[model samples]
Target: MEVKSNLLIQMDILGLIQANILTPVVLFFLLGLVAARIKSDLKMPDAISEFLPIYLLAAIGLHGGLEMRNTGFDSMLIPMLTAIGLSLVFTLNHYQILRRLGKFNIFDSYALASTYGAVGAVTFSVGLSFLKNQDVASEGYLTAVLAVLEPVSFILAIFLTNLAVSKQIKSKKKSLSSDLGNNEKILGMVDQSKTNLSGVLRESITGKAIIVLLGSIIIGYAIGDKGFESISIVFDGLFTGAIAIFLLEMGIIAGQRLDDIKKVGVFLVIFSILIPTFNGIIGVFVATALGLSLGGAVMFGLLMASASFIAAPAVLRHAIPQAKPSLYITSALGVTFPYNIIILLPIMFSVSSIVHNVDGSINLFNYFGIDL
Candidate 1:
């Protein structure tokens, strides 16, 4: 019993670091950081840094779509909805926690919600890499789930922001007290169009990230088996090379951010770090109960545990401008993003094995509504 307990505890710690440390993308990121710190002349063109994500997203989306094309529509729908649902729940949960912390207001809460709602491409990339490293199999359509979840969570965050605004307007007129009035003024914030659900959705669907992914999927689907055979040169061949360059850029960016990470308060920082870890643990239990494969379980844990910097922050800028970017950005980029991409995934995989060992007959696919 003690050995089992100790193993569980070790798995938890390994999970935390696994999310942050083991991936190749992170290694390249570290290399970039080291190069920058040492004053090496190495630099990614700003245009390239901006454009590479587009390529990455497009590649992932296309691959997912093509895979979905093969899987047919029926098997693909459930997981997609589950991904969106999880995204919404996680976003709202994170926002409420931030609000109770009292350092951020309603607008900030919305912005923060959107941010935590979406997924990180870099982190996802690393997770996929780990799957490949372990020779594990997962549904190809998950890439589509990744794409869909990004937009849906973003919309939910905006919806919450709008709700907060309505509540404020109603509260402002009800109480005639000076303190309440003061609170109103304090809570009042500028509204950016980016915060609107419609606007955020439009941006998400048409944005460079989604566009690339969708376009690639269509192309991949159109060509089918012949396409995979032909384009294997670029898609399979240069993928690692592209990723290395991408991580090198990420490393430099992360290192730059690390320089000022101290500005974000300890409470917020701890929350950012622990929340994902907590989510991953819960995910493990859910996956175990559902009887998912270890690969699927780990990926599911990653989806639940990962937070977004791109989709959420962009929306927050318009919907909740009053929210401090430092809290979300620093937390997501500086703390959670790094931790999950580098350390958490492997640990999740290991723990998943143990969970499955005790429950050998688990089969999540046959049992619906299990909350994986």
Candidate 2:
């Protein structure tokens, strides 16, 4: 039964991905990419381009905020903490893997790691839509998880980078300890102070993307249901269109960055695909332990698999200016994001379904003596 069920779930998820891929939102993104490749002069006006992400993030955050208002925090404390903790772990581990496997310098590795570690709100939004389309119910509070996780990987990544930088200073200058040079010691102090956790916290949380996302979440929470419903005309009704436009912009950017694929190469590309799967499986176990519904488990895994192109870039612009934009951006949006959206979501949902069902069957047999 387990094996048969697993096979059926895989087929079902593939069907779902195929069906959802044709939506206006995804289609617009494809359109933008094609237009860019053909050089048809398709471009978002700079003013409007700047406005779209804000609108989409606000819309998505408000939705999650509304959900949080619907579901109070006391009941969600365990899973919420689980989600946040796992996200942090994923970010830190991602940096380690990037450095180990990809040999990326401290700055670039951490930057890319943060990019992967952070959840992609857009991808999460789409995952929600996927669940909705299948009429699969998920916990509303997962949106809150998305909001809280947006800045986690970036901060953790920065911390990782700082740790590495400090270590490199000590390793390369181990002699400085015996030399007793006041000048060298003073410089070392400055470097260690630069890696201070407080500084990373500030820079990571202060990025425009983080600020906007968290701010929207707060505003959404404060407004509550009644207030949100009042503004649903703009935030709710037009949310899809805003996302379509945002993705259109993203598609163009991805196309422009395609040439950088050679820079990413095989090892990093392979790393991009695997890291999400690794973290996503960990998320599954965590969510499962939290007693989330099957759909909730898949959503958790989706958030795990997804990488933040928007938030990471916004923060990394300042945090790791030395990191190549193409390396991280292209890897996140071009490789990891696409892989998660196209392939990983369904696989996650299928795995969650299997676990949920197998668990249900075990409980049934234990309680009622019916195994079939």
Candidate 3:
């Protein structure tokens, strides 16, 4: 029976890859990539490129908010809080690895931390599609989990990076003060950093991304079915098309940095792949232990495994300008996103299934009042 189970898992995994890889959205993304590789004079309009990310994110938020209406907030409170806490912990875990193992400077370490910790919207879209294709049902409130997790990592990364940068500046003051003859100036600069950090914290909390996502969620929750039904078609009907446009733009952005692979080094290349897989397995365990269904378990794993190319990059660019943009963006969109959608998602689903089966046996044992 074990041998039979292993073989069936392998076959199902193969089917998942085949189905996800052949989808129109993935194909369009590939087309953009090939265009970039060939240097085909392919240029997305600057306006379109800038506009797509915001639109797609807002659309996702609105839809997620509507879903939250369909499913109330009461039952999902535990899973939502668990996801947020685990997400922040996940970010810190990677930040430490970047600082200690990779020997990255504090700014770069925190920036990479934000990138890895934040979830990918497009990746989640692909995961949702995967679940639908499999005809698996997940908790609707997983949508709220998606909206909240991105900003938690964003806020934490900014604060940590700013703290590190400020400490280093203070450490330099006594030594550099005499050489530069500017002790008073140094004190003034320190004051500026504090004010700046406060402003950044304020911006992050009320940023367009946060406002649009969280605001939509609240509105969706408050309005419930009838009110949302009035506008659901606008939000829901255009979601997939918007996601496709988003991915196409993402591929173009990623492909532009393909030349930066050497700059990213062997360490980041390996770190991006391994960390997500580890976090994803942890997510699967959390969801299952929380008693989510198989589909919800898969969504949790997928969210954990996805690296953010959008919000994380936006926040890090402003907060840690010293860190190289090409490295994080390329690593997330080019390497990590593709890896999750094609390979890791299927593997995570398989693991979730095994966990469910094992858990079932344990539940049965408890039912029978049998102890070893």
Candidate 4:
């Protein structure tokens, strides 16, 4: 029976891999990779490249808002809280590991921590597509979870950056008290760091992506079912196709940066892959413990596993100016993103399947005798 169980797990994993790899979305991503590999001069237009993300985020937000209206805030409260807690914990933990274990500088540590801690919008979309392909249903309100994860991770990272700067300034001031000029400079630096937190919060909250997603969600909720129906043909109908195209562009971009992986060194390359796998497993367990269904658990796992290439870079490049872009961006886009798409998604889904039971009738909560 033990052998049979192991074999069953293997079979399940194999089935998931086959199903995921054969999807049109994955195929388009591979095509983009191929185009980039051969230097085929295949390029997405500048306008379309910019428009796709907006369309996708708006569509997801609107759909989520509609679902949120149906499900109500009470049902979503636990999940949102779970998401917030996860973001905080993940960012701090990753920062510690990068600082102590990886021996990275403080800025780089915070940047990488925030990047990996935040959720990926496109990856979440791919997970939804994967679930749909498998005939699995997840709550649409999981979009709220996605929205909550990104900014919180970044905000925490910014706060940490300011804290670190403040500490260093104090250290410098204590050492240079005899020098009035140096003391004044240090005081100015201290003031700048203190003030930067507000700017960080504003930038993070008002980011183009956040605005679009939040706006769409509000709009979606306001319109409700009847309103969604009128516009469903645009938002709902074209979502998957838009994702495919966006991924194709993503593949090309990631493909172009394939060389940077070597530049980031073997430690970070391995770090990028291994950490996310660990995060995915943890995410699955946490989501299962929270009484989420199999599909919801898998989606949550994807959120935890995904690293932010888009939003993190936009913020971190400005927020933590000292950190190298290559380390975070290359590791995310070149390594972690693809790994999550091709490999981690199936692993997460399979783990969620086991946690939720193959028949989907029981979850970890029920097995553990916990009442939800």
Candidate 5:
């Protein structure tokens, strides 16, 4: 019986991996990667590249809004709050690890923390697709959770960066007595470090991505069922195809950065994989404890696991100019993104399945027939 159970667990894991790998989304992504690796000339059109993300974001937000109308706000409140809490914790923890253990400078540490702490929209969309493939149901408000997680993590990271820069400037100022030239430079840095938090907050809220997503959600809610019916064909029908194309472009881009993986070092490569896995497991357990459905729990885990290549780079490039884009971008886009999509997604799904099992008697030990 024990051997049979272990075999069953292995078979289940293998089946999931096979199913995910064969999906159109993953296949397209792999095609793009191959194209890039071999130096093929395949490229997504510039116009389409710009258009796909907006369309995807709008579709997700609108669907979520419609779902929210059906589910009501009360059901979403706790989850949103939980997402915010997770964002803060993840950011702080990542900063400490990157700074202290990884021996990175403050700017690089905070930049990376922000990048990993924030959720990826594309990854979340793919996770939703995975759930749909598995015939799993999830909360519509999970879209709202994605929206909340991105900004909260970024804002906290930016604030922390500012504080660290200010302290570093003060320390430099004290050490310099007669070096007027150096003191002047330190003063300039101090001014820059005093970046307006309120301004960043406003920008984050009003950014194009946030605007499209939030606006679409509002439109969706206001429109109701009949209104959704009118536009469902475009938003719902084309979403998967759009994602496949988007990921194709993503794969090409990630492939271009493959060489950068060597530049980022083995330590960071390992860091990118391990940290997100830890965060993902925490997200899964938290979602289960909060009584989420298996699909919702998996989605939550994906969001936690995914690192923001888009939003984080945009913000951090301006806010933390000193941080190396090569480091953060390569880690998030080149390593973490692929790992989450190809490997972590199936693992999260399986883990969530066990946690949300009907009898609550199913677990790794019992499922694998481990007596200990």
Candidate 6:
């Protein structure tokens, strides 16, 4: 298992920058930071930014579902399951590893776990863009995996944290019951401490992203090979354009949060990059094992290896309030995410190509999903 150091990896990344697709994402992100730093009026409108993610989720899901339809159930089902399950397992594993680095206790662990586990849609989109730009082929079905992975990780983290919270409550039962009975006012107040993990899991399962992705998947599958031709000309054609605008908006948002990023410090910042870097590396191995193409493997690796700032943080706010959102949010959004999108993806592609060479052939039947 000797990893080669090939110059092709460098070339691919440099080419991406030269192509001008990724640079804008990076530069606009920087611009947002600068704008926020200087307090400039230039800002991504709140409504637009909010809608941008929804558009991205919908587009990615539709594209993936349509692609999956072309591939048929046999090609997609296994990989989709593999992607979601791995996403859940690895996210929690990363949280356990990350716990030692910060002051994160069990509650904080759940919050951070979900954050590290989930993949950011923007980052995944960047990987897709890179693969397309290089003329490398990948499964559109993988997008369904991406959609599934995001919410499941959040659900798992909540379950783990709630279990811990429940244990703590049990330990204090006698005293806690007395205190609860004495405080009539507090008893009537909203039970912020209550951890209805099951309910939360149900909600996350039926979340907006999942709903759109599932609905579109059904539509795409029903349409079969035609691939929503009538509507795709509008939605599919404008997909990339929409993505660019969204990234620009994301850049603005990231820029606005730059000041808060400074509080994250050297160690956390290093971990942010390294964790995803590590995840990407592991993803290469997983993709290789799964027998995916160079393109599909890299994309899959990137998805598994990515961290979620969007869905995870939103869940953490409700599930683990004591955990500092700043640490998780800033780390994912400000650090690992951008690094993965700009640099890691190309490097991953090269790794995938090298691995595929071990037994060079088109193995389109297998992909990132574990079952596949």
- Please tell me which predicted candidate would have the highest lDDT against the true structure: 5
TM-score of 3: 0.84
Model 4 TM-score on a 0 to 1 scale: 0.91
Instruction: Measure candidate 4: CA RMSD.
Output: 3.7
Q: Which stretches of candidate 2 lie over 4 Å from their true place?
A: 1-11, 171-197, 358-372
List the lowest-lDDT window of 10 residues for candidate 3: 363-372
Among these predicted structures, which one has the highest TM-score? 5
Sort every candidate by lDDT, greatest first.
5, 4, 3, 2, 6, 1
**Candidate 1 error regions (>4 Å):** 1-23, 38-41, 173-195, 284-292, 358-372
- Comparing 2 with 5 on TM-score, the higher-scoring candidate is 5
lDDT of 5 by residue, 1-372 (tens): 344324334547668788789999999999999999999999989999989999999998998899889877677888789878987899899999998889999889998998999999999888888777777778888898888777888788889888877887778788886688778876885777666778888888889888998898899889988999989899988888888999999999999999999999888999999999999989988877776777788888888889999888888888788899999999999999888988899988878766655333565423322221
Lowest summed lDDT across 10 adjacent residues in model 6 is found at 1-10
Q: Give the worst 10-residue stretch by lDDT in candidate 1.
A: 360-369
The 0-to-1 C-alpha lDDT of every candidate, in the order given, reads 0.68, 0.75, 0.75, 0.84, 0.84, 0.71
In model 3, what lDDT does residue 206 have?
Answer: 81
- In model 4, which residue pairs have backbone atoms overlapping below 3 Å? none
TM-score of every model versus the real structure: 0.81, 0.84, 0.84, 0.91, 0.92, 0.84
- Candidate 2 C-alpha lDDT tens digits along 1-372: 456445546566668568667877778778877877888788899999888767777776777677777776665778878787887877778777888977888788888878887888788877766675566767767777776777777777776666767776767576566667575756656474344567657766675666777788778889998887789999877877777787788788877777788788888889889999888877775676667767788888888888888777767876667788888888888888767766787778776776676444333213222221
- Poorest 10 consecutive residues of model 5 by lDDT? 363-372
What does candidate 6's lDDT look like per residue over 219-248, in tens digits? 776775574878886567776667677776
lDDT of each residue in 1-372, candidate 1, tens digit only: 334434534545555465446556667878988887777788899899887787677666666666667865566676567667767777778777888874577766666666766777767766776676656655666676677776777677667767767666667556635576465454454222224567656767887777777677778778776668877777766666677788898777667777667887677678777888877767666655544556667777787788887666676666566777767787787788767767667667766655655233334433432443
Better of 5 and 6 by TM-score: 5
